[model samples]
Structure formats: structure tokens, C-alpha cells
Target: MSHSPHNIRTASAEARGRGATAALLIAHCAGMLDLVALPVWVGAALIGSMGLAPAQAGLLVTLFLAGQVMASLVLAPRFGRWPAQRVIVGGFALATLAFASLFLVQTYVLMALLHALGGIGAGTALSCVHGLMGRSANPHRVFAMAGLALGLFGILVLGSGPVIVEKAGAATLFVLFALATFTAAVAALMWLGQSQSVAENQADSSAPTSTQLKAPIPKVVWMGMLGIGCMSLANAMLFSFVERIGMDRGYGLQTVTSILIGVGLFNLVPPVLAALLEKRLAAGRVLLAGPVCQLLLALAVTQVQSLWLFAFAAVVWVGVMIFTHTFLFGLIARLDTSGRALAATPAMLMIGSAIGPLLAGVLVDASGYQGLGLMVAMVAVLAFGCFLRLQWATDNRAAVVPRSSH
Candidate 1:
């Protein structure tokens, strides 16, 4: 009944692979917590603690996002040359240090600078994780898992962040972020070595030559990146103001927070559903459904004043966004194969996010929330058009090959 040596080695390798995947997922979740949750959690703190206006408080978030975009754009393409594990560890260490230093700084400018530096660290960690995930055996599944982790983490942070801020002050949350990164760094240390093997093997067998690795990607991939950027832009615009929107509709703070938590909880559903359906359905069809649903839901949320109805729309909108993002990440991975596009995913998302609030604010000032919703819905429509064109291009190119073979 004893297993052979080869079987033992295979089993050990599989276990290590699972361990590595878990480590990456945890690290990714921790790295993204600030991106998804910090602005909402710290907005009031930033204003109250620093005596800044709401607009100025928002600027801190903008600086942080700008840092992320800058780092991801600059660092993602170097995954082939640099060791991902080292980058991840270094990024986490730097972020943890920055977060820990927040308590020592009092000025808005200094805090903004620290947040930006921390963002660079977080962005580096995220890009490395994305590169690793892109080159994984199952990028779609990894992304879905990562999305689920982030959603669950979002719920936990959203639920607890308010309490922590109220009782302990906003600065405590930064310490918590540092602890989370430290935990991720520990996890990374456990399994990141395994990731090196996976990366090396993928590089060796997939390309076999520098030319193939550096080959030109099609224009459709760039278009798809733009499309994703638009989607993120619209999403950030609405999401950044969602609580305010609810409060403006006469819901209390507690009610708005509850609604947001509900939305975050619902966010976990779509990625799981997408992962399950990915094998059974055409990815193109699934991809196309996401934005269409989002557009309808965006319009619905704006039109309805009922808290229950708006909550329902918000949940569904979040789910659709997650589904769309998972599919899009998969598409980019497939398109590039070199992981560069995958690395750019966070940058594209951050770029849209950075633009979203500005655009939404302008639209709201000119025409109110109704106008904002309409503008975002239009952006979604345009994004859907981009995806449709991508699908058509892919299908047409595929059709050409068989005819040429004949």
C-alpha cells in the first residue's frame, strides 16, 4: 500500500502548489484592501483629524491611486526579469513601514505623501501578484478566487472599519493595514519560492524564445484595456458616491452603511458564478452580458428612491462588475500570454478609478445625480461596444486561419 517515490514527489509538489496559490490569494487580498476600502473608511477621519474639507480629504485618496497607477505601469512589464517573490516581499515590507509611520505624521501633505508611498508598495505587490496569476495554470480560477477573497475582506473591513474608527480613531486603521501586510508577507515567505518554479517553467515552455515573448500584441487587447478602464471609471464614480447617494435619498448613516455592506456581501456571488459557468458557457457571451446588466442597473438605481430597490440594484451592479472584471482579466491573460497585459490590469483599473470621481463630480455639479448616472451608463455602453468589437475581431481572425489552411 506504500506509494512510490515519484508519487510522493508529485503529491508534495501539488501540496506546495496549493500552498503557493493560497499565499498569493491572501497577499492579493491584503494588498487590495486599501484600494477598495480605505477611502470609505478614512474619509471622515481625514477631514476631522486634519481640519480639511471634503474635497481635500478626497485628494489623499487620489494621490494614493495615482501612486498605484504609476507603479503598476512602470513595474508590471519587468516581471520576466525580476523575481516576483522578492518584489512581493519588498513591496509588503515597504507598505507596512509606511502604514506604521502614519501615526508619526500630522500634516496633510506628509500624510498624502506617506499614503502615496504606501500605494506604490501596494501597487507593486498587486502587479506582481497579477503577473503570477496571469501565468498560472488557471488564471480565470485564480482571479475568481482573488475576487472572492477581496469581497469577503471588503465585507469584514467595511463592517469593522467604522467601529475601529469611532472608538480608536482613524489612525488605528493604518496600523491594521500594516498588520495585514505583515501577515501577507509571512504567508508569501511560506510559498513564494514555489511560484518561482512555476514562473520559470512557464517562461521556458510557453515562449522558448525572446522574440515570441516580446512579440507585438494585437490592437484589440489595447482596446479591451481601454474598455476595462471605462468600466472601472464608471464603477468608481458611482461607488465613491454610493453612500452619499443613499443618504441624499433620505437614508440615515446606519442605513447607508448597511446597504453598502449588503452590496459588498453580494459582490462575492458573481465571481463564484462566473467560475462555475466559465466552462459551460461561451466566455464572449458571458463577457457581453456583464456591462449590459450594469447599464440597466445603474439607470435603475438612479431612478428609484426606495431603499430596498436601490439596495437590490446596488448588489446586482456590484456582482455584474465582478463578473465582467473576471472575464476581462481572463481575456487579457489569453491575449498577451506574456503577462504584461495582466500586469497592466491594475493600472488600467486605477486610471479609471482616478478619473471616475472627477468625472462624476462634474456631471453631478452640472446636472445632478441623474446626469451622473446617465453619463456612467453611456460609458458602460461604450465599453460594451469595445468588447463586442474585440469578440468580432477574434472570431474573424479565427475564421481566416482555416480558410488559409485549405
Candidate 2:
């Protein structure tokens, strides 16, 4: 009852830190949900509600993702200079308004415009989130926490999104997207405001500030980003069509929806596993293996006729990307302590994601699911090559350290 003023100040600062962390988690989850719920957004809303052809629907999603890539690329370099609170609040508010506007628009052109606007806002917020993570004391674990939050969000989206879209129509789903971003914006406004005490505490917990934020990112970090982009491309290429694949294979709506739920439930693993194995596992080997696993799974899900096999492959397809990308995110954070490279995380991931759906759509229309597999095979080859180079660079760096120390 007789606490000193210093003790009270410390407690308040700790509370603000916790609040900031919570805000970050919510922002990360909300900002990333479009990519997370790709199957529903692309398959159900665009194809089912809007009655767009596969390639056309894919193009709509591609436009949104391209906007995200462009915004993140433009904002990430300035992330260190801008205030995080303003970026997050402004970005999510714009996204919320854009998503909410979808309820009033029916034309494909109008919807596409809104989607691109929403993507720009979401991408700006995401850059801030990733930049904060990169500057954290433990980027790997922080990114893992964000991934873990996304897993929970994914479960809700996959579990309920189909039912909601089925009952209330696609407009309702867009409304929900607006609601999610609005929540993040409000949370950021309340918790991540430019409070000096919170800022000081965050700075204390962050990595050293000696790194020049404007310095060019190292080549190894660029390779790592390329590896992530390829993996993301391969992932979204098949994932955006998981529901359609099931339907095309003659699976009933109920059965496919159940399998999608299974996919969400299974997604809860990799981030936790990555956090646990942060130091124990070899990142290079995981990076090398991730693309191969993704390719095999893509082929399995695409080529298999068996209901159980397809369901199993679809359920676990995203986990490998989550696991490998966690390590890659951490690696890039270490390589580029300035945080600019990590701030471009959305750009790195979404550039390929933007291409994935349209490319897959073209392939599927031309040569069927088997053609999609071939495309994934080619992308996986590029991913493997990038990761191989990353591994070599990491090994060379490790070898040089001991010699330089001596």
C-alpha cells in the first residue's frame, strides 16, 4: 500500500507494454486475414457470389494483393521514420472504410477499386507490425507469436466464414472484414498511441539502434525474401482453390466445408512448433525442405482422387509454409537489424501471392489441375534454388566469424 512513485511508474510502463503487445497481435491477425482466408474470399465470394470466371476472380484478388505489395514496398523504407501508431491507425481505418463500402457496390470495377484501396491500407499496417517485430529483442519468437495469432484467426474464418457467406451473402463477409480492421484500428488508437513512456519501454526492449535504417539490405536478406516469396507463391497458387478443387472433384459442399475446417484446425501447429524449435532445429535444412514438401502436397491435393488423401493433404499444406517462414523471418531480421527489410515482409510475401492465383487460374483453365501442379513444380524449383543460396551464404558467414575473431 505504500509503493514508491518509481514503483508505480514501472508498473504503469509494464501495463502499457502488455497493451502494446496485444494491439500488435490484433493488428497482425486482422491485417493478414485476407491472405489467410484466401480460399473463402476467392472461391466463395468472388466465384460464387459475384459469378466471376476463375481467371477473372483470380485477377480481382491479384489486384488487391498487388496493391498490398506496392504499398508495403513504398512504406517499408520509411517505416523507421514514421510513427507506428499513425501508420497502423490510418492504414486500418482506410481498409475498414474500403471493405465496408463493398456492401453498396455490385460492379466488378467498383469492387476491384475498393479491394485495391483496402489492400493499400492493410499493407501499410502490416509493414509497421513486421518492423516492430524485427526490432524486438527476439524477432523469431515475436514473429511466431504473430503467426500463432493468425492461426487462431484462421480457425474462426474457416470455421464460420462459409456459413456466414452462405446465409448472409458475400457482402456480409466484406462487412466482417471491415469490422476486423476497425477493431485493429481502434485497438491501435487506444494502446499504441504515441505515449513517451511506452515508446521508451519499447526502445529499451528493442535491438540496438546503431543500425542505419536507410542502409541497403544485404544480398543474403534479399535471397531470404525471395525464398519466402516463392514459398508464398506456391502456397497461394493451390490454396486459393482448395474449396473449388474439392467441389470439382465432386465433393459435396458439406464435406468440403468440413475439410476446410480441418485445414484451419491443423494450422494451429507450426507457429507453436517453430517457437519451440527456434534454436534446436537447423534453419537451412528446413528452408531447403519446405518447398519440396509444399510441392509434394500440392501434387497430392491436386492429383489425388481419394477423399481422405485429398483432405489430409489440404489440411496440412499451410503448416510447412508457416514453419519455414518463421525461421526465415527471424533470419532476415538478424541479417538486417535496421528493420527495413523485415518491414517489407508483406511485399516479399504478397508479390508472389499476387501472381499465384492468376497463374494457377490460367493453368487450370488450360490444362486442368495437373497443369497447376506443374506450375507449382516450377515455382518450387525457384524456391529451392533461393534457399540453397541462402544456406550457402549463412554457412560462409559462420565460417568467417571464427577467423575474424582470431
Candidate 3:
């Protein structure tokens, strides 16, 4: 049977959309391995195999996050100029090599360098993914899908990672990361080329040129980035130390591990809920609530001595971050039509994450767990303030929500 020309075009577009979604999901799952499995990679493995002090381990992780922030800042502005497919494929391939190298390295300095290099590669790929998602019909929906994928990935790694690390050794975790990234790169090669074609076909005359892309990002976008970054800072500051806090309060290892596992399991729900409520809830209003909720949770986790209370707060913490950040991501996507600012998503996130552990350590040393809670409160206020400023920008311009079919 012969198909109509319009039907053929529709079918082809659907096929391309499906392909792009698959590529984004796979690449996001792989690129976010470090973050989703942070407790395993940073807390457990580094202390166990590398024999580093908690501070050293934290610093090492910080170095890796610093690399991500640095690479994102460099690449995101030029994202429009570069070929997205090549950048993503090359980035993951580089990360594959770096993660593999990590399995062989033992010295702290060598390990730190390898971690940084791996972070750079992973960050580059992740930035491009954000850029692509921003350019899609519904950035919020696409990002929510990615978040759901990451949550599932988190469950698998968090549930199994400790056992694997215990049995096979810390270095095996690096091998797992290498395999994940290698798979992502191979998958991108198979699928992301189609996404590139779709992007090119969708490009408009107003699409930013090299010269325009090089121009400074606008103030509103920067504000959104900073707001998101502040939320990340508070989340990471407390999250990095949650297990330690529980143990210090006399919670058993078994209980702490169970909380982490619970966190992984519960992580699945928030993104699904966010996706469902995308149009029902206003992103701007939700953005304002995110920081406040983060502060309250941080305080609960740190100040609560009861095992149940602490566990509940700790488990919900990262999930809230995921849910709230999804809206912020979509909002920023709308604010930046060129997709360049959204491309810097990694930088905004990692800058805060990079500072979080170091700052938490200092605060903990200076005062106590309460000190960390105080820091979260301060950061939360900053985040709320930034989001508040964004209300005027969004309210004044109704065009922020583009007229496109989701």
C-alpha cells in the first residue's frame, strides 16, 4: 500500500522523536552514574580501597565535580556552534577511557586527576543532552523522562553497588562506570545522528549564530542558573553527610544502608509525579517552594535524633531535588531560546555540588551537624530569593511558554 506524503512525514517525525528520547535516556543514565551512585563511589569505595580519609575522599569528589563545572562552562556557550552528536559521542568515549584508567590508578594524586578527566568527559556529554532537551517541544517533559531513567538507574546501582564493591573491590566500580559510558557512547553512535538531523530540520532563522552564541548569556538565565545552583548546594551539603550523621547519632550501619536503599526506591515516584503535573502546576510557583522544602528537610535530617524521622527526611531529600530541579530546568529552557544557557545545566549543578562537601566539612568542624543545617538554610534563602526575582521576568513575558505542541 502506498502512503500519503504527509503521513510519511508524520511517521518519520515520530520515529525520530522516539530515537532522540531513547538516546537521551541512555546517555543521561550513564552520564549521571557518579551522581546517582555518589554514596557508593565517594563514601564507600574510596574509603575502602583507596584508604583515604573522609576529608580526602570528599576532596577527591570535589575535584571531579570541579572538572565538570569547568568543562560545562567552556562547552555550553559554544554548544550551538559544535556538532551535538560529535560532542556527545566524543565526550562519552573520552570518559570511557578515563574511567578505565581509574581502575589501574592507586595514588591519590593520580586517582584525582583521572576522576577530574572522567568528569570533564561526562560533563561535556551531559551538557549537550540538556541543550538538546531544551530545544525539544517540551523541555519539562523530556527532562522528567530523563529524571525517571536516572531514578531507575539509581535503584540498580544503589541496591547492588555495595555488594559488588565488597566482593569485587573498589576498582570494579570504575570498570562498571567504564562499561556504562562505553555502552552510552555506542548507543549514541547508533541513535544520536538521527537526533542531529531532527535538530537541523527544526532549526529556525532565529537560531543563534556563532557570533550570537558567543555573546554573554542574559541576566534572567544567569539568575535561574544561580537559583538552581543554590538549591543544589544545600541538597549536596547535607546529602553527602547524611549517612555519617546517622552513624554519629548511633544509627547502625544496617539502618543507614537501608535508608540509602529506601532513597533509591522512592526516587522513582517524584519524576513521574512531576511529569503528570507539568501543565497542572505552574513551574514558577513550584520553583519558589523547592528551596524552602529543601531547607526543612535538611533541618529534619540533621536535627532529628529519632531514627524514623531522620530516615524519612533523608530518603525524601534527593527525590525532592530531582522533582524541583525538573521544573527549574524547564523554566530555564523557556527563558533561553538558544538552548545555550540550558546547556550549562551541569555547570550550575556541579558548581554547587563541588563547593558543598568542602563547605560542609568546614562547617561541621567549626560547629557540628547543626552548622551544616544552618548553611543549608542560608543557601535555601538565596535560592528562594533568586526564584522570586524570576517571577517578574516570567510574568511580564507570556512568550516564555512557547507556542508548540507537547
lDDT top scorer: 2
> In candidate 1, what are the lDDT values of residues 142-170, reduced to their tens digit?
89998898888878776676556667877
Which one wins by TM-score: 2 or 3?
2
Q: How does candidate 1 score on lDDT?
A: 0.74
lDDT of each: 0.74, 0.85, 0.81
Tens-place lDDT digits, model 2, residues 1-406: 6999999998887788778778888998888886579889888888876678889889888887888899999998886677788988999999999999998899989988998999899999988878877777678888888888888889889888888888888888898899999999999999985641223355634533545665777888888899899999998899999988988888988998898888788778999999999999998998999999988898888877889989999999888898999999888877777888988999998999989888888888899888898788789889999999999998998777775552
The C-alpha stretches of model 2 lying farther than 4 A from their native spots are 195-211, 402-406
Better of 1 and 3 by TM-score: 3
Q: Model 3 TM-score? A: 0.91
Give the 10-residue window scoring lowest on summed lDDT in candidate 1: 199-208
Clashing pairs in 2: none
Index of the highest-TM-score prediction? 2
Cα RMSD, each candidate = 3.0, 2.0, 3.1
TM per model? 0.89, 0.95, 0.91
The runs of at least 3 residues in candidate 3 whose Cα sits more than 4 Å from the true structure, single-residue gaps closed, are 1-9, 194-216, 397-406
Instruction: For candidate 3, give the lDDT of residue 56.
Output: 78
TM-score of predicted model 2?
0.95
Residue 312 error for model 2, in Å?
A: 0.9
